[model samples]
Target: MTEDFVNGAAVQALLDRASGLDAEGGDGRLKAIVRELAEAVMRTIVRHDVSESEFWAAIQYFQEGAAEFGLIVPGVGLEHFMDLLMDARDAEAGRTGGTPRTIEGPLYVAGAPLVEGDVNLSDDPDDTGTLYMSGVIRGPGGEPVEGAILHVWHANSQGWYSHFDPTGEQTPFNNRRRIRIGSDGRYSFHSKMPNGYSVPPGGATDRLMRALGRHGNRPAHVHFFVEAPGYRTLTTQINFGDDPFAADDFAFATREGLLPVPNRQGDAATIVFDFELQKAGASTEEGFSLRARAAV
Candidate 1:
């Protein structure tokens, strides 16, 4: 049908029933959200006049690529949009000044070995190109933030993460560490340089990107979660400015302040960055979302 039919009383009644609008013993907020979502999808179907075969094919694609949905979320910009939404809210709340938060891709693992000071995260002999990164955590007023913990993880030279690598060559917790900031609020780590990577060739993300005339590639970067007591937890990452995909990240994670230029000498490189964190207004801001994360 058309937009008129999709918005008619008959469809509204069906949606209300489907979303359990009048049903008791269910979440009222969830029912309202589901009804709105159903209405939006129905409008989209009518707007595009999508064929039954096309709709079923799309559903099948999602079912087959369930494993890659995490990547697909960032690939299509939903993840980045979430960051932007939070940023807007923070601005509205008058929170300002700090390292800009960015998308936290679905690769973070919890419980890396904690170190008191500078540490080496790369232990795999197969990894190449030494990297030395140091940074300080400061409060919003530019004072040192002691007792901060920096959780860091990155891919290897071949763009394979430790636990998720399919080749089974990387050791557990390879290129991952939990560094405790010194009393001076400084933290440092050594690791092999990470390489940029593209979406799995011919996979769901790649297929969808190609269909939309886009490339699915992300620049070489390191992920981090910096947190301290009484301070808002910061989720951010640094992309290598020299990488070709640094500015063209398919995940839209390339922020102006996040691209740090690496100073190289021979095969070794160094980067120095600093972070500022606002005071937490509530307990909820002191930790990250309790999303399911990998361990070990």
Candidate 2:
């Protein structure tokens, strides 16, 4: 009972701080979310009038659960959270340009191998899927940004990433590639398209979902992280040409504008994606680059 009362004080302190907030620094919108989270935490904590020791034991899962997650997927959630807020913030400030930013999964590791043009991503001898991704990276004027960098990667048939998949041979950047945008902001690569994946079978997300009797599955898609100087970075994906589960993506990562038209062929073929970005400061930074960003 004493412990519960102390927890109540903690809750009130949080509420007090959150309720008195500013839009820019204090973020009034965050107060409601804090309230909801506080209530949830209280619900789990106040259930049995447990002893102080028991309460600590119950709270241990927060750290354990977090440690179970990888670096990539966690950022996906953060990306989504930021995207929602930034969209409103940008609109309020009248900043615009480029396709809307989306989440970048934790699977994105830096320092991929660079190449001039086409990349053969399928490493398995038995694997025979071909996909060609081409595009122009453009600036605010809708003009091409020459020498932009396009880094790409995708899962194998088993829906596993290169660094994580145990079934595949131990090779670094197996399904990854980096391409330089040509004089006209044009870039292209060749690889086997990706398939969708389900959540980790028995983690906190899945444990909660299973207790709530929900299914955990995500739709098929390929991932990309494109970078350029004087422009923000673009971390997005393209769903399989005709994935039935695209709209109902388990992760709910699929967006209408995020989907691209895929051109499949028995023979080698290609499709073009026109990428664009607004001038920095003139618009909110959408696709950030380190080489120039650090210089600024």
Best by TM-score: 1
TM-score of each: 0.98, 0.73
Predicted structure 1: lDDT: 0.91
| Residue-level lDDT tens digits of model 2 in 17-54 | 65553234566667778766766666656665667897
For model 2 the TM-score comes to 0.73
Query: After TM-score superposition, what is the CA distance of residue 109 in candidate 2 from its true location, in Å?
Result: 1.3
lDDT score for residue 277 of model 1: 90
Residue-by-residue lDDT tens digits, candidate 1, 1-296:
66998878899999989999978779999999999999998899889998899999999999999989889999999999999999899899888789999988988888888887679998788547898999789998889998999999999999899999999998989999899887899988898888889889999999999999999999999999999999999999999998899999999999989999999999888999999898999989999987678887
What is the lDDT of every predicted structure here?
0.91, 0.64
- In model 1, pairs of residues that clash are none
Tell me the lDDT of candidate 2.
0.64
What range of 10 consecutive residues in model 2 has the weakest lDDT sum? 287-296
